[model samples]
Target: MQVSDYTIGIDFGSDSVRALIVDVTTGEEIATGVSYYPRWKKQQYCDAAANRFRQHPLDYTESMTDAVRQAVAEAPDGVADRVIALAVDTTGSTPVAVDESGTPLALLDRFSENPNAMFVLWKDHTAIGEAAEINAACRAAVTDYTKYEGGIYSSEWFWAKALHVMRDDDAVAKAAYSWVEHCDWIPFLLSGGAQVKNMKRSRCAAGHKALWHPEWGGLPPEEFLTGLDPVLAGMRDRLFDETYTSDEVAGNLTGEWADRLGLPAGIPISVGAFDAHMGAVGGEIEPFHLSKVMGTSTCDMLVVPAGHEGAGAQVKGICGQVDGSVIPGMMGMEAGQSAFGDVYAWFARLVAWPLENVLAKNTSLDEATRTKLIEETRSAIIPQLSEAAEALPISDDILALDWFNGRRTPDADQSLKGAIMGLNLGSDAPRVFRALVESTCYGARRIVERFIEEGIPVEGLIGLGGVAKKSPFIMQTMADVMDRPIRIARSEQTCALGAAMFAAVSAGKYSDVSAAMEKMGGGFDAEYQPDAKRAAVYEGLYQRYLRLGEAIEKETHEDRDDAAAPKPDKRSVAEPSESELL
Candidate 1:
């Protein structure tokens, strides 16, 4: 009997960490486990009102250990012993300030409760001012550092977040020696790396978020960084000068982590990357095919073969075009909506407020019965809303903007807010919900259109993640709006599976990512074809969406300018009655 080699893929999402054990030869997911971050679950170190989202380092370390051990326990006997390697994928640009020893500042007792010391989450928009400054500085620089990053810098990225934290908290800045992305920090920790300088940075995170490009060397020059802010002086030297792709090995798992995870001590660990990049590979992304990871936010990934037509063009208003970011030898282009499923979730929460806030406080019912009723009602909200909305005919009477969390692509602007238009007494929850869903789909269409406008072709779309698997209404709506069929990947955990593919390559089980994907991929299980009538109606509604978006964007900027403009000072001008009469 032949024994198969197994690999573990760990995915650190915004709310939880999941571990997946896969059979290397067949891509069969042997077992899986998930552990939500206790601190994050309790809403610790996060301020939703201020858009300040953070995660403690302990949340990552503890949850990952629990998730991996759970997966190992669930797997067949001897599978843990047969595990050959491990790889990690995480939410990107989620960075933390670190000390000289390569430990997060939050892990130290002195800074234990400091939110500024914790990992700045990708969704945090507190750095909007900092991001604007970086954009202005980049434009003035001798070299356009943001050229590869679609000529726009976002608040949800490395430098902007780091600079925001640094300027906001003096203690964190004074003690911090360097900053590291969550993706890079995990592999270093598992490998027992001690020195900050020794950590192997990820190309995906660096190239896409840190403004790293081959043309200008590793990172933007120190002069450029310091010019943006004196606080960033000498930061380039403290941080990494080189980056490695996900297929490369970071290091062997140290005995400490091995024992914690119930795996072999010396198994190779692949270099880390952002979750969506690996997820695209797991979804079996092909050249020119857009892989849409539809979760809280949507990450749209497209790859073009090297030397292909328009491959080298600097597409404007995208996340970035990084070589080997997705596939080893392909050029990967990324664009995304800051709010996707999040938009639906926000509406659900809004409509369920009475059930949660008022009903929970009622003294009329027993505790258990009330709890059950509330939970059931809350859970059924989306499904029932979808059903009701599906029954209604498509109309332009109601429309919404999906910028509840601000836009992430087609030019990132976190200042933009969501809008609902054409609401009246007749406009109900289901109608509003349908418009919100359509807005998110229209946001996706804008990304697709941007790529096509820039000479990059989008042949089709491959959908993956939580929304793709569960929501038929949203998926069908997306198909109608896009006028394209979307093939949904079979694997529920594509991000984790993608990490396993990189692990296979790092462990020498496969020659490259493509080989691993071809051998181990779980192909699409369902496809959503467009409805011609609905599509035609949506085309007009989509045009309306564009016009609405343009008007809103202009008004948003005008409002911002009005707020920022200096007000007339009554004290500065003499009172006309007394002075002129005298």
Candidate 2:
């Protein structure tokens, strides 16, 4: 009998941490455990109105400990003893300020409650101004630092968020020695790394979010950074130059972490990476097949052979194209929408306002009944809305823009806002919801079009994550809008599974990621083909969406110009104008 080796994959998401144990021989998932972040569940250290989202380091440590131990306990007896290695995937560029010892500032007593000292969530947009300045500075510089990063830097990325916090918080800025991405920091913590400088940075995180490129010798020059802002003077030096792929071993698990996870000590741990990148691999990604991780946001990944034609093309307005970021020896390209499933969630919340506000205030019903009613309604909103929206006719009478969280791809512009047009009293909830759904699909199509226009063909799409698996309505709509078929991965936790595959490779259970993927991949379970009639109708509606988007974008720029224009002196405005004087 061939003995089996097991590996664990830990995925750190925005709200929770999950641990997935897999049998390497058969790619069978043995056990899974999940733990939500307590502080984050209560909405701590976040300001939605200001677009600031922070996560405490304790939340990560506590939740990870709970999740891993739970998974170990749930597995068949002695399976935990057979576990060979572990890997991790996390959202990025979720980075936090760290001291020289590689400890997150939030872990220290004085900075424990400071939001600026915590890990800045990927969706946070507090650094819009800082991002713009970086873009401007890059454009004016001798070397364009953002060329590989789609020629645009986003507020959601590392430098912009770091600069924003440094400028905003004096205590954090003064005490911080360096910044570390959530993906990089987690592995270092598990491996018991001693110093910030010794942490092995992820190529995916560095290339995609931190503007680290080999062309300019990894990270923009110190002179360039200081020129952008004096606060960023020594940042380049404090950060790393070399980066490692997820398949490589970062280090061995320390005795402390091994005890906490209930696993053997000194087992190899693979380098960490972003969730979507690893999720693509778990979904059995192929050359030219776009892997769309459709969660709160959509991260679309495409891997092409390193020697493929146009592989060296610098596709504009994408997230980034990094060598070995997804699969080693392949050119991994990324693009995404800042809002995907979040669009539906936002609409549901908007529609549920009266129920939560008014019904909760009513004294007519008991507290228990009211609570149950609210919970049921909130849960049913999306499914109910989806069904009704599916029944509505496809038309361009109403259109919406999927920029509620700002545009993230085909040109990242966080300043843009979402809008719905042609709405009247007659337009009902279902109708509005339908338009919103179509808007997201249209946004997706735009990304596909951008890739094609840039000479990178998207042969098909592999869908993974909550929106892809749960909502057939949205998936079908996406197919119709793109006029292409969509394949949904079989695994519920593709991100975690991908991490396990990497862990297997690092532990010598497999020679490389491709071999591990071939052995462990969960094939497609469902496929959505574009309906002929709907596809044709959506073609016209999609054009309307583009027109509306153009108008909105133009208006947005004009508004910004108006805002930036120096206000006319009050005295001068009150007095006669030049024409009147003449």
lDDT of 1 by residue, 1-582 (tens): 888999999999988999999999999999999999999999998999999999999999999999999999999999999999999999988999999989999999999999999999999999999999999998998898999999999999999999999999999999999999999999999999999999999999999999998898889988888887798888899998799999999999999888889999999999999999999999999999999999999999999999898789999999999999999889999999999988999999999999989999999999999999999999999999999998889999998989999999899999999999999999999999999999999999999999999999999999999999999899999999999999999999999999999999999999999999999899999999999999999999999999999999999999999998998866645556666778
* Candidate 2 local lDDT, 1-582, one digit each (tens): 777889999999888999999999889999999999999999899999999999999999999999999999999998999999999999998999999999999999999999999999999999999999999999999899999999999999999999999999988998889999999998999999989999999999999999999999999999998997798878788899999999999999999888988999999999999999999998999999999999999999999998898679999999999999999889999999999889999999999998889998889999999999999999999999999999988867789999999999999999999999998889999999999999999999999999999999999899999899999999999998999999999999999999999999999989988999999998889999999998998888888898999999999999998998998777755688889889
| RMSD in order of candidates | 1.5, 2.3
Q: Which pairs, if any, clash in model 2?
A: none
TM agreement with the true structure for every prediction: 0.98, 0.98
Best by lDDT: 1
What stretches of model 2 exceed 4 Å from their correct place? 573-582
How many steric overlaps are in each model, in order? 0, 0
